[model samples]
Target: MTSTIARPAPDATRRQDSAKPRRETRLRALDGLRLVAALMVAAYHYGGRGGAVTEAWGSSPKVQFPTLHAFFSYGCLGVQIFFVISGFVICMSGWGRPLRSFFASRASRLLPAYWAAVLLVTAVFALPVVAYEAVSPSDALVNLTMLQQPLGVDRVLGVCWTLWAEIRFYALFALCVVLPGANRRRVILFCALWMLAAAIAQGVDEPLLDLVLMPQYAPFFVGGIGLYLVHRDRRDAYAWGIVGVSWLIGQHYVVRELWRAPSPDAFSNRTSLGIVLVVTLGFVAVAAIALGWLNRLNWRWLTVAGALTYPFYLVHEHLGWVVIHALHRGLGLASAETFVLTVVSMLLLAWLLHRCVEKPLTPRLRAALSRTR
Candidate 1:
């Protein structure tokens, strides 16, 4: 009798690769960056609560912190970082694929988990809390389609507002990818035109126009697309150089000066631009690191943390008020204690969501899609 050799199924290998931990990917640096962004968002919300405490009890003997308000202000930058990463990843993944397939794949991956989150939030907020609003069915339906951004509907789920931007970028980029002669030069030119339009709309004080056009954040996404092009062409040096330049722009211009401005209006005009530039640079740096131009940092914990980022982002912002209310009632905790507990809870909840929701669903979805194809 002859011994039989065993072979793995074709779909098994694909599933295994897709489901592998973040550590196995060459793109662990990107995941690390995602984790940082997620944490920054959580910090931002916690910081906001601190600001509220300072505002409510400014003269109270127990409220003696000067840095509390300042801490919450920078949390908004996390969204910019997220926009950059979304641009880069979507561009890279959709490159060379048919537009239909690209849209379908993205829809399949994003919509299921997102709709579930929306339902969960809607159900929990059926009765309004201070920060949480009860949404109408029509509003929720519009949000479910991810078209609320252009419609000027403030997000039903707070964190999902960013996802509206993300979905728009995917759609716009998909159109570009499908267009005739939509090569590098054309894509760049198109992005430049879009950026100019956005800037002009913002300058005119048309917040609705600006929101609809999403002008302020287009460059970071375009920059990500540019990075993808460079990577695809194997222009490693140029990619890293872009990364370095973006870092310098962000550090020297945005974070240092714009972030310090006292007026929100001035900061929006001057510093927000700088933040956008720096975030774009962040995308470049991530790309360079992924391509091995830069040595990887051995941050395994960060890698694991990054895996929980999407879920963290989903839960952290909306649940923040709930957490703060609970802490105020139960612990009678100071702002600092409240902040720490909120962050810890966000991380722990994110870890659970990753294990319980994302991990299980992603594989099954991918398998089902493969079989259907």
Candidate 2:
């Protein structure tokens, strides 16, 4: 589809959509949401005390950003927001495609920039740029698999831990739900089975079970799939039930993680309440987009934002931190100025990755893979 479509006349389109939901139509607002989620993560990494940026900043980042740190501290939860969005989008994309096409689509979208980012981060840090030690060669090779987490190898860059989660989620969704055909009953079944498995995994306290099942994150992904059903199936009761069940499980996990985290941001009823609010709002936002509440948000810029999101996220963390450190420490730029310049540079780098690497290679990659099927 073209990037921009004129908004169809509201009354007739809305009436028809209300009567019969459009399964194939794009949810434009989700693009904007993805961009917001990525920025939230960048905010957390840059402004919170979690990363090397703290060393460069001299004092606590909370001291530097003051008012902003309170909000940014919770921003790592943006990864949860991304998991929800991935569920909705992956289901939408994979619905009718064959197994080969589904995998081709996923690999093409995921791997090109991923390879680039892994290499970029590895090479950049191999220099004496930061105080960080470079990743070992063997570790870097394993990282290329994106299964480093399960294989007991450390991540070579920031934000990669989530990629392993996404990889596993894709495997389960492809093998069980998507390839077999995604109807309401089957999607709901997957959710039910996953919920049960996750509960068992959590109770057993086995590392293998927890890694394979991902008890903490299964809820958000399942909830997103449920929301996609609601979006496509006109307020499906089974789908809504799935969403509700996921929210209940997800709420418990959110609160537990917040309370137990061994960080400065840990353990306040108020912090848990704030995180719950954000997670709830993310789900509600998707629901609104699903229910046609956001049908008016058909702007094109969001489409561009969506295109940039994956590349931006993959490359942002380490590269941006180095930028922050160099600008502030080596160049003697002030904190505020350094922050803006670093963010802008990261955006430019993301755009270049998209325009130069992804645009050129993704189609060829997909075509080559699909040929095997």
Candidate 3:
């Protein structure tokens, strides 16, 4: 009859409460943007420049969707969008937490869903596209770690490379999280130093340094972080300078990729490069959204679309490819029909993953992880 409930310490209560505005700033627009990015990636893998199977798929008269292919060709640009969004969201999530808390939160949010995705991918590819080759124990171990490529082993899924970049970003930001003083200023300084290191590495002709610094993609993440600062009413000359540097670097990266891209004999290299440059507008679009230029994007359906993004992204490419190949080969379906069917099937699978795996497991896993701490 004489029991008293313990309450959170005053400082801890303030820390938890102060995190609300950060959460409140979660725009439905960004979720819509995420969904758009995921769809773009799926489309890219189905018919865009990155998809190696496109030529064979398009050769058949029954499946030629020239218009659709053209639209999705620029879809790789979506990855840049995701990068920028990642910077913004990561900063928001880590704004007020201690380093360990931030790390735990990120791990809890990402790992369980990712592990499930890995298993799903393994199941889909179990029978093999060619004759079934057994997955080696070493490869399985590497895949389980999700650090296969960095460890000089093959990835379980090709798309998993982006997760490596994400890991690097998180690790780099953790340093800033652990630093003393204002989080916003610490982030700004981190961005500047990161870009400076990248510039120096490039100047010294040390490609390994470039790899470590990741100058090619750093611009988008830095730009996104800068935009968040601007959104938080912390914009100043220094912040703008960082954003400008990031934008310039991103512009250079876009041009570099275009230049290195093998130009088809059907079109001049200039024309091909120009087309790609136009697609780089995706970066601008993301920055605009962060800068409050697209504040009117509040659609509920888009929010739902956003919520499904991670699962959709995880399940889309290879699994869809499997379905496409199977339908085209066994069922004698047209490439067009197979493409449509593959997309539909992938969407249903994504929904199931979101509901059955992500939704049910994420909070429980987070709770369990908290107990460990």
Candidate 4:
């Protein structure tokens, strides 16, 4: 008796779908957005703080570009953009991975490039000819961990303060992933708990809780996670609401915080408004990209821009300050010309760092870690 069982077509379709690798959507526009965020941050660090030449560093040069400084004052908003992107990317990355895997991925992605930059910056600070104060050996060691601030040590670079916040966010997200399992339901629940904690912290005005919860920036991350949920499951009105509310709260926080202290330049009011505007635009753009409104922007070079952003961000600022100071004093470059040259040099340095350190080491490190696991 040759009895053959008939298989349903839906079962076959399900099997096929299950067998295929789940390739997440590659939104090239987000890559472009990364470049924009990085540039804005660089601008904020470089030009936003206007000062007299005799005051310190080389910010005296920024006075030459008052208009540029005015626009760049809003560049701090880029950090908010980055926090949102991190949330979105982390959700995407941690979707199916274990806690250890997520930790490994984050470490491999961040540490090597960071270590390389640290070494370079340390070298500069260590040299007396540079006249920058030397980084103590213990502090440098702490800096190597990239948890300097939270660990109660000085950051080797000023911008590194943001990295600790990022690490904390990653740790919190990992806990969420491990607890409830990665799913749309967990995202909503996690965000609700986070915001509730934030509200309590604000009410109590506890510094420790504020430090731990980082409520000031939690909404941005929540908004990003909400965007991911909305994208992955479009029919969820609850997720949509989470996104809308989170974005509004985050925007309000930014405006209120920054509007309090505008630079004394003529563009003070304009700068405050610009900062708020850029932040609002950032949220809208990311949401639009998440919802598939701007998915068609598939420029290959934008990937390069995105790739270089990390190195560029790490290598700019303090190092650029030193370079500008040297150019003005050592090379007889004018304020405007020194600013331009420093920017160009930093871009080239970023490209080299990406090509030499980040690109080659990240894959090998991740692979080695995976093999050990």
Candidate 5:
């Protein structure tokens, strides 16, 4: 009798083991940071500039929370922070994993809560109570694909635009780096080429390139990639160089954003330094964690907080507005009271979604996706 066991070629095995760090290990501090970024976005929508629903508060959001709203204007940068973290997390997680596995992991993480939110928002808006645009069935179906942004179909939830960017980054990473079996050299090349293409996209004003390259956001992602490399100690100088260049370009884009896309009036007067500083601080924070400067951030509760971030982000914007509209307008709650309650209620809902839908379904989806050829 004889038995045979398949084995990878020695070189293939070496490449698989090339990454120095335990790539699958969790960084608890990053979970904490993810929670923070999600809250910042929630604050921005619920209390910041305050006009998301156009009189949802019954008066200007600025007039209601005057002092806090001023600071909250900068909360919009939370998305930028998420992008940076995504770059680091995606690169770290995808390393040495096959493209199919990466896709399964991402699809499992993203689709569950997203699908729930899309249909949930559509059903909520179906009542015709909110002042916002209605979500038709066709729109809901398109949005479920998470490609509604590129397809020019209106989002069932306003925040889906961010998902579009994230999925694009995932696609770019999957096709360009993960597909080839991510390692130090390939990731380094990916970030470098992205930066070069971003510059060309911006300089030439090419819409398609801008759309694909995401010139406005490329640096944060690039910087995150560089940070992952730094953590791996692949080549400290080269990694730092990528991080530095990313921030430098990131700074330039932040400054240009004022001219490129004028913000709502509440944010118009915010200093460019404020915007640049917040974004710069994101890079600095990720870099610090990568360099082991913030290792004491390993609190256990942060994992729970991180678990809620996605579902929280998915369900917050429109649903929160509906809450605000009802509390402030229908029930006649004071603006501040409504704000506090809306935030709390959203968290509770997020927790429910995380517990019921996301938690139970993620593994099943992962397993199903894993079985796919």
Candidate 6:
């Protein structure tokens, strides 16, 4: 006997909506943002206090070019932008992958190149020509583990301190992903609360808990997560508008003016707030421009720059230092000439590193690791 089967209720059918096909599109604006941020970081390293051309080059005075220095000093904000981007991208990419595979992919992408750079730097310092102090064993190990930032050791590769922070953020993000029911909204809310607590804690001279727990700087990463949600929901206009306005305002008022004053500590508090706001907004803007109606504006040069950024960042500062030393001894170039030479050399070296190292290793390593997995 044939029995009549009842159809499922509409509400029951609606509950299965979670199986809907999710959108997956590359945002070019993110590439542009990455390019800009990396350049800014290069500029800061090229133009700031540690960047001053040393006395080893005969009588040439240090190049303290006012405008360039001011712009480069703002490069620290670029690191913050990176933090946000990392949070958003990693969360999205690693969302449902097995924990082992997720970490393996991350390690494959970051470690090989990083280890190569570290070894090269180690050799550089070991050479008598470089005339730098030797790194201790503990420092080397810490740097290798990407834990030197928290330990407060002098950064192994000057700029590598940020990488440690990036790794820490990645680890924390992975932890969040493994938790039960950790949706986009929950991540955003957690990050928001963390940011507020961090802001409050920043003012305290000696806080009860150390910086890691509250991690006042975490909000920027949170902002990136927030950007992911906004983008996921397709609210492109509102996100870009806010980001554009906030960045322009912060760049003009705080970074360009107040923080540029003579005193080293001038506007420290204001600068902090401005950086957080600007980075948060900048991520939104980049995401909006990438995903919004403005996709046509995504330029190829920005993509190239973004692609090479990791190695460029690693090598640029050292290249500047090497140039200043050589020019001082060989040509006795003035600060202006030295500045010009340094800039030119940095670009050339960045391009070379990309071609010879990063580009080749990235895909090859990914493929090799995928096979192992």
Best model number under TM-score: 5
Model 6 is weakest, by summed lDDT over 10 consecutive residues, at 13-22
Better by lDDT, candidate 2 or 1: 2
Models sorted by lDDT, best on top: 5, 2, 4, 3, 1, 6
lDDT of 3 by residue, 1-373 (tens): 0013354687874564344334455588888888888788877778765334543353522136545655656666678778888887887777776765676678877777678877777765576454223356568666878788677875656688888888888888877654342265577788889888877887897868876788878888887787676666433567667777787788777667744445453111323455446445655666667667777887777777876888778778767766766788668897678877988888788788878887888888777766653
Q: Give the per-residue lDDT of model 4 (tens digit) for 53-154.
A: 223334342455656766766788899999888778887787766666677788889988899998899888788877567578899888998878877886
- Ten contiguous residues minimizing lDDT sum, candidate 3: 263-272
Residue-wise C-alpha lDDT for candidate 5, range 213-318, written one tens digit per residue? 9998999898998998887663467888999999998878877774234456534356777778888888888887887677788888888888988998998888
Instruction: For model 5, state the Cα shift of residue 8 in Å.
Output: 22
The digit string of per-residue lDDT tens for model 6 on 309-348 reads 6766776666567677777566777666876777677667
Tell me how many clashing residue pairs each candidate has: 0, 0, 1, 0, 0, 1
| TM-score of model number 2 | 0.89
Cα distance off (Å), candidate 4, residue 142? 0.8
lDDT of each: 0.61, 0.82, 0.70, 0.76, 0.83, 0.59
* Segments of candidate 2 deviating more than 4 angstroms: 1-23, 260-270
Q: What is candidate 1's lDDT per residue for 1-373, written digit by digit as tens?
A: 0113343486763453233122224466778888887777776555533344333223321233345444445656777777767766775575445555565567767765677667766776786544445688788878888878667775777777778788777767776653332344455555556656766886797977766567656756655655654554444455444444434433443455445455643212335554655455566565665455654575677668767787778877666657766675555787677767877887787787677777778767755665533
Ranking by TM-score: 5, 2, 4, 3, 6, 1
Per-residue error (Å), model 2, residue 224? 0.2
- How does model 3 fare in lDDT? 0.70
Better of 4 and 5 by TM-score: 5
193 in model 5: Cα distance from truth in Å? 0.9
